[model samples]
Target: MRAHHLALLFLAACGSDKDPFAGGADAPPREDGGVIGDGSTTVDAAPRMCAAKPSRVVVLGDSITACSVIGGPNTADCVSKKVADYVMAQHGATAYQNHAVGGAKLSGIAAQLNAIQPAPGPALVILYIGGNDLSPFIFQSDQQAMQGYQMIEPMLVSVYAAVFAKLKNTTTFPDGAVLLTNTQYSPFDDCTASPYNLSATKTGLLHKFNNKVKSIADAQGADAIVVDQHPAYLGHGHHYNVTMCPHYAAGQTPWMQDTIHANVAGNVGLAAVMNGGVDRLYRDCIQ
Candidate 1:
């Protein structure tokens, strides 16, 4: 490979600010298969011959999907943008759309899905939500919080089932589409600072939510993919703190923008996780 081609690969892998999503104009097309954002080549190694790639990619969720904190001139650093770019690069996708609102919750997902203008061809939908739904209980008393959390599980399960059902019933795709769901990861869970406690109850609820997401994916069968983000963000950095306290650790190099949202580096981390999930789908389902 030439130096410039190597450079493009690096940028794509890093989810850098540069035009990582630009059409693969400079580099020659891969005969084997294109690499994912994490720099992993496809396992099949044979050109995709089975399933048709998506014509459009759609992201649905809350502020996390909106890239609310990671905004800047380099919009490509956002997680949705990174995923869109990856699909375009790897699958020849032409369009990417995100319908994530800043404060969306699981209950509101149906409306988001309803609002989507279905594409004429196959569309990949990425769903990253439930953080807002659980955020309210983060600081509640253990007993009360656990009760609330317990109630949330059924709601989450129902909402996810409905969302998947809607996709399966309503969308019109020549080749078929896939739905990718994600587990929530909060840097605040790792923060040791006062008032930013990661209580045992909170931790337990987080695990439950993640398991719920996995269960939904399992129940949905091949079309649903779960991108586990909790493990990926663990130990990456401290949650961002607006009030400077001498005792509190500052945000790590590139993981967090605030107590809630991820910085550009954190967005890159998320993109990498999503990329891994997409690659798995290609190897196991598409191929």
Candidate 2:
């Protein structure tokens, strides 16, 4: 790799301002069969792929991290598909597991984690949730749903606290970190989403949610990946229809994955951002 490439990689692991989604020149696709933020720039080893000592990993969350396929198509990436595979390859014998379920409440997540196989060794836990439960509160116009998002705050904290507490008690999560993803930000406009995805109100709601996640980490003194990175990364932070949600909706075809959730390519980029981003956050948290 060139010096610039090395710097880019290092920055990816450190700099919060560096936006990988900001394509250099719409570069062409690589031979590896994945997508990039843009087609520009020379392709290299996938960030999710292993180049370092491998680590066992467990992912616990909602639909985004659970439902791995739609019909014949595969959706889960960071773990189910390439990232986990690569990590296994890089780490040289890493065990992996997914305990996430679609449409699950935080309560469900706690139970699922408890029931899943404990980590085999030094491992990382990717807790990619919040899209479903939070959305009801974010998009709901009715007082119940809207207010649900508000009260959902403490529910969320409880969930995280429970998860961390459990992980700490078990041997599975030793020195393992949580790759925490923030809520929805997309290209589609929520306000015009036929039923509002995010108006200013919902945006504020997420902002609060993000803060709560951080707060939980602070109080618990746990390691976590904070993805309040950028609105530009989540399709400029636009909201679309629920049915269009890749993590939730039953879209018409595999193509709809890109329209709603992160496509294979999108998730790969997400994995890159995540792998590097979380490592950065972990080091910072420990510091």
Candidate 3:
């Protein structure tokens, strides 16, 4: 919260430069989580028990969470909007905040996490990260990319722990909040696509990273849910044809507008993934 500390945050998070993964104007790619870049500041609020449904929905992470499209408003048909709209329609009451930055990596989350002001009732904090961390290494050799994953894995653990520590306790969420995190989904379609073929070792890293996500969420207990997005996105990538992907089926189309970011239909798919999680896991609290 100190001026120097804020300065340090920006510096530490500036390593990879622009968000290599989910590009587009999700708002100028602030790795600082909009702290000083966008005039956002931290807030303090008292904790309260959860209602029948979450009273607040806070979305965090990269452009995917912001629903950054190729040539449109970041919020246009984004996953966050879909979820928010669903909550409003189903529950009739909620406050939604999307603090996701376009080019953010896990490091950017510290500022985003710090900025959250807990309100009454349990909340749902949806996070999608790790893609930006892995994206830069894609063009590198297999060994180099794996090394990059090794370097970035610790940051993921650290950030995820900080989030669970801050938001999973009684002071922040009295009845326990629902934290949704996910594995990275590939737009390369298992390396069968052109121009972005990830080597076996590089593709393996995806699973490894996803497993780490699951372990971290598992260790944090039931309050956290690790939605597996990788498998869900497989058949929807660029090479969905039978020649490129055997899983390709009728009516399937590319979910991504580019090699990194999701399209409108993809965002809708992502929203559906989260919505299903809420319905299955939080059925007691939500209808």
Candidate 4:
């Protein structure tokens, strides 16, 4: 988090009202001898092939990673089943874990990361967050809504900064790209009566925020892969599958609306973006 919010939110609790990221929960020391929470490591090498041996991939994000509402990643009938299936298709020895949980606000990301296993082999850490932080706890009135956004932005941004800093020079995945990305948002119903429904503004804000995160990645010298989910996430009016939900109505799925959350088709599309997208972060990017 930015230094100020770090001071306020650092004590007492990290997530779910408990001091989730307590010490000792930190990832084990790296073979590289780097310290945690200090931004010193920088991977200047180009992308390399996955390890010759079998590999374990770990995704740390919010509901998207955990495959929430949907099952966690490869769990039976989970939305992330699609994601896992695609990854497994290419790499037969691939084993992966999803640490994402829904409602995992900024505070929650730090908590979960502490508990996650460090990257095992040829690791690719996919991190997509900041949406829920951008989302407010439903406000009762317009004035309250404005106040909430004002108060939350810095807190959220600072948290975003600290979380980014910790992971940017990550001791985990010492051999691979630590891909930093933000959530993909499509259209959401406008708030006609409440400023609380500022979905579009939030959408606009994501671009700005992602750029800021990109800056952090640059500071640490890692890949800042931009996996824009907006275009593909488009539906009739621009809404997505409710975060972790899979039961889109006949009219809401990608097939139905062209932009709800990924039906099997949409999921595959996202996988494609992720696959080639990060190549730019570490390898090459065309103008």
Q: In order, what is each prediction's RMSD in angstroms?
A: 13.4, 13.2, 12.5, 11.7
Clashing residue pairs in candidate 4 are 1-158, 1-159, 1-162, 2-158, 187-238, 234-259, 235-259, 241-261
lDDT by residue (32-100, candidate 4, tens digit) is: 211111111122223323222225545666655555534457764443454455445654427666776
| Ten residues in sequence with the least summed lDDT for candidate 4 | 1-10
Q: Each prediction's TM-score against the native?
A: 0.73, 0.60, 0.75, 0.56
Per-residue lDDT over 16-91 for candidate 3, one digit per residue giving the tens place of the 0 to 100 score: 3332122233223322111110011101111112334677788898777866553322355888878777776775
Ranked candidates (lDDT, high to low): 1, 3, 2, 4
For candidate 2, write residues 25-122 as lDDT tens digits. 33333322121122222123233221123266666776556644332113445434444655565445366677777666666886777775644455
Which stretch of 10 consecutive residues in model 1 shows the poorest summed lDDT? 1-10
Task: Give stretches of model 3 more than 4 Å off.
Answer: 1-52, 70-76, 91-93, 169-175, 284-287
- Model 1 TM-score, all chains together: 0.73
Better of 3 and 4 by lDDT: 3
The candidate with the higher lDDT, 2 or 3, is 3
Task: Determine the backbone clash count of candidate 1.
Answer: 0
Q: Candidate 1 or 2, higher lDDT?
A: 1
Better of 3 and 4 by TM-score: 3
The number of the candidate with the highest TM-score is 3
